[model samples]
Target: MYGVILKIINRLQRNPKRAATWQYLKFIRLNRETKPLILYPSYFSVFLILGFLMLASSKGLLSKDINEIGDSVAGLSGVLAFLWLIVTVLLQNRDLNLQYNEIKDMRAASESQAQSLESSQIFQTLEYLEVKLENISEYVRQRRNLIIEELENFSRQNRIMYNGNTMLDLVDAMDYFVVNSSDKDALEFELSNIRNDFTYQSYLRIQAIYLNIEEVVVAYEALMINVPENIKPQVTKYINAHKKSLMVDWCDKMLPYTEKLRHALMRAVVKHGIGPEANRHFLKIFAEKDG
Candidate 1:
C-alpha cells in the first residue's frame, strides 16, 4: 500500500496539471476563509465512511436493516455529490474571473503600444517634411535672386528704369496711357502689342517660380491634413512661424512682397488676353488665392 501511494505521489509530481492543482491548494490554505471551504468535503467523506464502518461492526444487521442503511447511504451520497458540485462551480467562476482580468490587461497594453507606434511614425514624417520645406525655401531664394538679376539686365539692355519699380508699376503706366489718350483705340492697340511681347518674354521664368510656390503650398496643406487633432494647433503654429521666416528671407530682408512679380504677370496675362494657356493659369491662381 505504501509503495502504491509513493508511486501515485511520484506520478502526480511529474504531471503539470497536478502540480498546478497542488499550487492552487497551497494558495487556498494561505487564505483562512477559503481553507475550510476547500477541506470540508474531504473531512465529511472521511467521517461518514468511519461512522458507517463502526455502525456495521457494532450490529449484526438483518437483511431489511442492511437495505435501510444502503438507502440512507445513497441519499447522503447524493447530498455529498451536490456539495462537491457547488465547490466545482465556485472554483470555475474564480478561474474565469482571473482569465478575464488578464485579457483586459493585455488589450490595454496592446492599444497603448499601437498608439505609441503611430505617434512615432507621425513625428518622423513631420521631420522629413520640415527638411523638404527648408530645401524648397532655399531653392526659391536662389531662383528669386536670379529672376531679379535677369530683370535688371533686361531693363539695362532696353534702357528702361528698373530701380524702385515693380512690374505692377509698368502695367499701371500702360493702363494710364490707354485711359487718357485722345485716340483711345490706337493707344489700346499699341499697349496690347507691348503686353503680348512682354508676357511671352517673361513667361518661362515666372511660371517656374509660381510652380515652386504651388509645391510649397501643396505640401503645407498635406501636412495640415495628416496631423492629429490633439496636436494640430502646435504643428500649425510651428509651420506658420517657419513660413514667416521663409517669406522674410524670400523678400530679400525687405517687407514681404507676397509674390508681387507673379501676381503682376498674371494680371498682365488676363488684361492683355495672352492665350488660353495663360488664361487657365490665371483662373487657377485666382481660385486658389480666393479659396
Candidate 2:
C-alpha cells in the first residue's frame, strides 16, 4: 500500500496541473474576500467540532438530555459536510484536467515543428554540398597539372631569390611580374618578351592559377552559408586544407587589375555559390612572414 501510494505521488509530481490539485487537497486555503482570514479558521473549527461531537455521540458519551436532538443533528450535518468536501475536491480535479491536456498538446506540437525544421536544414545542406563537390572535383581534374607546375616553380624561385622559402619571396615575385608593370600593357609585353625566355611561361602559369582563385573563393563562401552547425567544423577543416594554394593564387591577383577580377569573382560567389591540413603545410609560408 505504501509503495503504491509513493508511485501515485511520484506520478502526480510529473503532471503539474494534477499536482496542483493534489497540493490543494493537502492544505487549507483562504478565499479572495477580506473575510478569508476569519472564514478559514471558522470552517476548520466547525469541521473539527462536528467531527468530535459525532465521535462522542457514536461512543454514547453525550448526556441523555442533549443526546436525542444533538445526536440526530450531528449525524446529518457531518454527512453533508463530508459530501461538500468531496464535491470541492472533484471540481479541482476537473479544472486541473483541462490544464494538463492543454500543456500536453502544446509540447507535442513543439516537438513536431522542431523536427520539421531540422529536416529542412539537413535537406538544404545535402543539396548544396552535392553541387559544391561536383564543382571542386571538376576544377581539380582540369587544373591539376597547371596548379602543381606553378607551385613547384614558386618553391624553386623562392629558395634561389630569397635565400629561403617565404611568402615575401612569392609576394615580391608576383609584384615584379604583375603589380609593378609600368602600365597594364607593359605586363603583357614583359611576360610576352620577344626573346621568348622560359620566364614568360612561368608568368603565364602564375596567371593561370590566379584565374581559378575566384572559383575557390566562391566555393568557400557557399560552404560557410549552407553547411549545418553540427558538422561544420569537420567540413570547414576539409575546406581549409585547400585554402593554401588558393592563397598563393590570391597573391597573383593582387595587381590593381587582378584585384578587380578577384572582387568580381567574390561577387559572383553570391550568384555561382559553392578541405584540410595540406593547406597548413603550404600556408606556413604566409604565416612565417606576418610582419
Candidate 3:
C-alpha cells in the first residue's frame, strides 16, 4: 500500500497535466487534490483527528449532551474545517504547477539527448589509418624494386629504352598516345579530384598499384621477340610468374583501365622488338581477368 502511494505521487509529480485532469477534478471535489490519489485516505484521517481534537478542547465550554453544544462553538468548528479544506486546495494547485514546469524541463533534456545520439557517427582513429598506410608503404617498398630489375634486364639485351623517362612521364605520355592529347590539364585536374575524394581514393590507389604492375608487363613483352627462340620459353615462364602477382592482387582493380594500359604495352612492343601481331599477347593475360 505504501509503495502504491509512492507510485501515484510519482505519476502526479512527473506529469502535471494529469493532476488537473477531470478524474483529478472529480477527486478534488472533496476539497481534495491532484495530490497522489492514494494519500486521500491519510489526509482525510488527519482532518478528522484535528476536528476531534478541537471538539475535545472545547469541552470545558460545552454542554454534556451533544444536543446542548453552543451555537458559537459549532460555528467555529465549521470555520476551521472550511479553512483546512481551502488550505489543501491551494497547496495542491501550487504543487501541480511546480511539477508541470519540472516536466517541461525534463522533456527538453530528453530531446537534446536524442538529437545528440542521432548525429553521432563512427570514425576511424588516426592510429588505425596510420597502420594501414604503413602496410601499403611496406608492400610497395618491396615490389617496386622488381620493376627496376625488369628495366635493367632490358638494357642488358642491347636495347636503348625509356630515354631517361620517369613513371610520371610514361603515364602522361600514355594519355596522349592512347586516349588523345588536347585535354591533359583537364584530365590531371579530374584525377586530382578522384584522389581527394575519400570514396574514390581507395579505388585510385588500387589502380595506381596495378598500373605499376603494367609497366613491368610492358617492359617484358616488348623484349619477347629479342630473346633467342630456345630461351623465349624460359623468358615467358619468368614473366608469367611475375605477372601472376599483379593478377592475384589487382586484376579486379585493373579491369576498368585494361584497354588503356594495353595500348601503352602495345606502344612499348612496337618500339622495342615486337610487331602489331604481338598485341594478342596482352589479350591473353587480360582475358584471365575473370578467372
lDDT of 3 by residue, 52-171 (tens): 668766765354566555565577568667766776887788889999999999999999986665433111222343354344544543456553443343333323344433343334
**Model 3: clashing residue pairs?**
none
Which model, 1 or 2, shows the larger lDDT? 1
* Most accurate candidate by TM-score: 1
For each candidate in turn, the TM-score is: 0.46, 0.34, 0.28
Scored against the true structure, residue 149 in model 1 reaches a CA lDDT of 59
lDDT of 1 by residue, 1-291 (tens): 999999978988889799789879977766655556577766787787778767756764334576777786787788779878998898788889989999999999999998898788668766876886676677656544554555555455445566544344333333332333455453333323334446444544445544554555555566677667766776777777766765522332121122444554555666666657756575557846843
The sequence of per-residue lDDT tens digits that candidate 2 reaches over residues 1-291 is 999999998898889899998678655443444354345655776786688678767877655567666766787678667766766786678779978999899999998998888777666665676577656755654454454455567657543354233345434444444433455554342323212122434444455656654445555666678466875775666556555544433422444444433233222222222112443343344434431
Provide the lDDT at 95 for model 1: 83
Q: Clashes in model 1: which pairs? A: none
lDDT of 2 at 155: 51
Q: In model 3, what is the error at residue 105, expressed in angstroms? A: 13
In model 2, which regions exceed 4 Å deviation? 1-90, 140-145, 156-211, 223-291
Candidate 2 contains a number of clashing pairs equal to 5
